[model samples]
Target: MEKLELTPPPAILFALEPLRAMADYVASLAPASQPLPQGDGHPVIVFPGLGVSGYATEGLRERLKELNYEVHDWEQGVNQWPDTEFDGFLDLLSEQLKRIHSQNGRPISLIGWSLGGVYARELAKTHPKLVRQAITLATPFADQPNSTHAGWLFTLLNGGVSPMDEALLRRLSIDPAVPCTSVYSPSDGVVGWAGCVGTESEYHRNIEVDNVSHWGMLHNPEVLRVVARLLAEHRRGTFRTLLDTCVTKLL
Candidate 1:
């Protein structure tokens, strides 16, 4: 496989994040007046992106809660890259997943944002029986980690460690054993959009939303609508590609 370098978005486009966030916030409000599919009270865990706490995902978690899902935040404080071979952070996350699964008496759904999505996919692969499904927002697991705008920051935080170490990158490219959805935007300012595509499988899908910034994903109404519909389909025991769902909506 050819090595891919980080392809950051244009500075001008990246700079529009704040404005896009505001627009998304305004658009998100409109979803309240529209009918949304109700959730089935299944447990869903929301993971924050790198260097952020649960606060980063509060809007999304609240929306999922409003839709009647039992949602939990990954309260593990700021998510730092693992420093040890054992990966204590992932171990802690694993324990949390098992705890949540045992407590709910059912498999849990995982929603990861950016780096958190990478974690979600790995967790599902390791603990498939404990995961109902995995959903990722702008996660770049399919490409070299340096292909993200945050790559420099990640390297700095990890004592100049490279995330593209052969073994780790290979693992990231493998498909998880559970149903997966990757929500990505071609205009994402932080990570290369091509890096976010999930492995194609009978249970995996890649959904593209136009003109949304990476930061705005949490508040984007269109993204939320897609999530809501997917949750509803999961609840109904129906498996449909996002393309199929979009076609149904057009009809």
Candidate 2:
């Protein structure tokens, strides 16, 4: 097993090369068929990670739609730098959740990738009634320090937002009460592997995949399978994993 690195390589190209390979590998493992259900279903909002473009996630959204999920892309354009802008993102998220609740007449399920996962968790925190289930792929707790080359660079550039302050972390980290699942990999070429762990408790789940890079999990077939299964389980009113005892059925 490759050890996760907190320090990013100096070369930008080198750091990103592994990500490209991972993306290609994930693309190769695409499932042959993703069947959609035949009727109206709960709304599912898909949030892609930071710096990711719409093109990167089009396939994933299509797959969700195939599975009959009413998928909505978090159309905030490219997720370049939300931390710096802080653009009332929480407010926008609140509005979106309210709209989804009103439109669907129920809570919405969220599948957020990377930083988008942070947004998804915040939604659950602010409007728990509007979120049925929240799943995050490679999204770190706000309190944890990120380990990407860019993450370090941004921290250096921004003076100091250390990822290891206990008080600060407690303030920023997501609570496990929102039925959250975090998917991560030890071999992730991006983000500190340790930062991927969910809050220590029964309500949160931390799924570790082997050898998959951070970017790769976005489109990895097995990851998609787990996501689809979880969504289906939620639909059947049996969403809790065996690992978590809290079961709330809403149909």
Candidate 3:
């Protein structure tokens, strides 16, 4: 019998300077995780990763709601679903965000997983006024043209033929002014570790965790803690408590 080989997600090999910068930024922010008056009843739109369905993340969504966040799912089916084109993907996101604003009179927050993170960033950029903040889990901004193996396969699986080049990276990289948080692990089972790092810039924080696979991270308690912290800080204007917790854990 032939044994199957599991190719680990691409690792991030480099000095820790950039990661330290990200960590410091997160720590510097004040800690406050409370519901915002703006969010009143506005729903949070969640974008799941490739081949991931809402059912799989129901627990997480419910958990957030329990924390007082109104959670909404795209329900676009898993990565295996055939008709998932990029343009159509964007259209759906635009409509959903608009709908949330219309129904709740407030901007919505986006929590994107894997490839879905890319969409979340784009939506925030296009509708900055309507998107309060974006949380990307294990997403990347690879040199578009030289993106890692998984990115290429992802493109093939989804529709679209734009080469991963500097242009694409520049276009997709979230603006510095937009509040965005990227949660990633060096040991992810898919996507290169480098892709997870947020470029040295303002209002962008990258968090690196240990022992989380690309898929497993969606449910990792630590990751959830980080997400809850980020979202709460954004809506409530306090982040020091959580930052202190993370600092204590690191120490």
Candidate 4:
């Protein structure tokens, strides 16, 4: 993996979140396929970005529900990271995964945004059998620890306890055992885009979107469309079709 320079000047673009939100709202008005792509109603849990509450992902949760998937919120309120201790947070997530798996009698999919994406990837690594797939939005797992635009804020919020230590960063760089899709944008102003790239493999793929804001990823219509398509493919076991369709759409 290539090292990314975390220059603060470019990161100031994150302040344009309001503009991105407006654009996302307009994009959402465009018509997509009716009924979208139906899923098998398998359970899905969405995790919010750092310092954000589950409500931040309500739009995505609703969209997933429209696809007939059993979507769920993290229900852990704001993601305060080390406040709950990393191990405790993982335990909570693990418990939720187990409960959902037991109830649905099948593995669950995880869709995480930003820091939440980190958690999703780690969870899948720890318990691949419990996860059907893992999808991340603009997550910076490939770069060295602490090399993020939000490092300052993250440090202040966590009381100087960095979540991305050397060991954890090394673990995050490896591909998870389950099917994984990383949805990212070069225009993202929060995390370095290079760090968001997933190592391509039989089960790992990266989808790059154009002109998408880091914060707008959860509500970006194009991103949502690809996510819905990926979920549908997973449900239907259409890997070849997915590859062809993604190539066409992305081109």
Candidate 5:
């Protein structure tokens, strides 16, 4: 196993992020890419990363939709620090999840990216009954803020953060009661990959997709296929080996 890196990624890997992001786009459009393990029409909510909006997740959401899930983006505007409307966002999120679950009579699935993954875990803690499972993409919820290269940008956007922020960081590391998955890449260019990994158990699994960059996690086709497989199962599974047996072998 590679070292569980505590510091930000090296400059070379960080520098490759934008280029890998571009290649992800090309790969998504290539005829070779295909959806595996089709979804079961469960409702899913996708949360965006920091400094981005739902638009950034359009491709990912579209892929989920193609897999037969009822997918919806957060629609929470740009993900800004000092989010003044977060309480309101949570309120609306609760309404949507409850409504979807009531209508469909199935627990909703959550797919969150980066900072948004924090929201998903906390939300599931409070409403585990409404959530079937959760999947986090490049989310460093278990790490200190400074472990990420983008920490400074968060501080700059919010002026300064308080020491109490560590309390939330600890809370983020707590696994949700329902099934959960944390997808990580060793060469992640933004957040430290180690912190993105949650403690693994029967209901919670950490998976490694080595080719992904933090910036490329959203639209990378393999990531989509992984999510599709988990959602199709509609329950917890031996997903740690899913990439090796399902994703790689299919390719």
Candidate 6:
């Protein structure tokens, strides 16, 4: 099947992120989904999206904690350019992954939202032995980096795309060595959903939910259930489409 062309979401729709976020807050207060799988107490690191701080992912980390996974937030204050300072954030990320992997004595799971997903995928590829699986939320990992409304902002920050930008985009599109899951919604108000769901295979899969705007992917209750299922699937086997997800069923 031919993939849809990538484009920024409509301005009217994109403006609803705050509304969706509000809805997520209300929905998360009351559990609506059926029983979700509990985690095996493995470590999972969640990376925040571009231009945001770890506070944005606090709800997501809390939900994962309820599943019994050791969840940690990216310590870098506010997310900025990957190559910003201190030998770059990726290096910092690598060190953190190594420390966590060493202390836990088990591979860790990487979950990233939007730009954070870019980090999760890259780290998994670079250090598969240290990673059990990877999950991305509302991330545009496809080749067309300029497809989102905020794409230009990124370009401006990076001082225009260079060879490094091209290389990173190429790497982001590639699937990680470990099991990978992408949770996205067609109604996402930020990045286009087409690029959010990477290529699906035995180890790589996509879960599409309803009513989750790009910003809401972090706090959306349905998204939490999806993550819980994927994390629980680690012990049984690889993640697949037929995971009894409440995402499609309830959403």
Best by TM-score: 1
- Number of the top lDDT candidate: 1
lDDT, candidate 5, at 222: 77
The 10-residue segment with the lowest total lDDT in model 4? 234-243
Q: Give a tens-digit lDDT track for model 5, residues 195-218.
A: 888767756778788788888898
For model 6, the superposed segments whose C-alpha errors exceed 4 Å read: 84-88, 159-164, 236-251
Q: Could you tell me how far off, in angstroms, the CA of residue 241 lies in candidate 4 after the best superposition? A: 7.3
Q: Which is better, 3 or 4, measured by lDDT?
A: 4
Candidate 2 steric clashes: 2
Ranking by lDDT: 1, 6, 4, 5, 2, 3
lDDT of model 2, residue 235: 43
| TM-score, one value per model | 0.90, 0.76, 0.71, 0.89, 0.88, 0.89
CA RMSD per model (angstroms): 2.7, 5.6, 9.9, 2.6, 3.0, 2.8
Return the TM-score for candidate 4, rounded to 2 decimals: 0.89
lDDT of 6 at 203: 72
- Write the residue-wise lDDT of candidate 3 on 43-117 in tens digits: 687877766677766766876787787889865667432365556667876987898789887767788887778
User: Per-residue error at 139 for model 1, in Å?
Assistant: 0.4
Off by over 4 Å in 1: 1-6, 31-33, 235-243
Cα error of candidate 5 at position 33, Å: 4.9
Clashing pairs in 2: 36-66, 36-68
* Distance from true location, Cα of 248 in model 2, Å: 20
lDDT per residue as tens, model 2, 138-206: 776642454454476446544566434576466446563566778776666656556667554545667
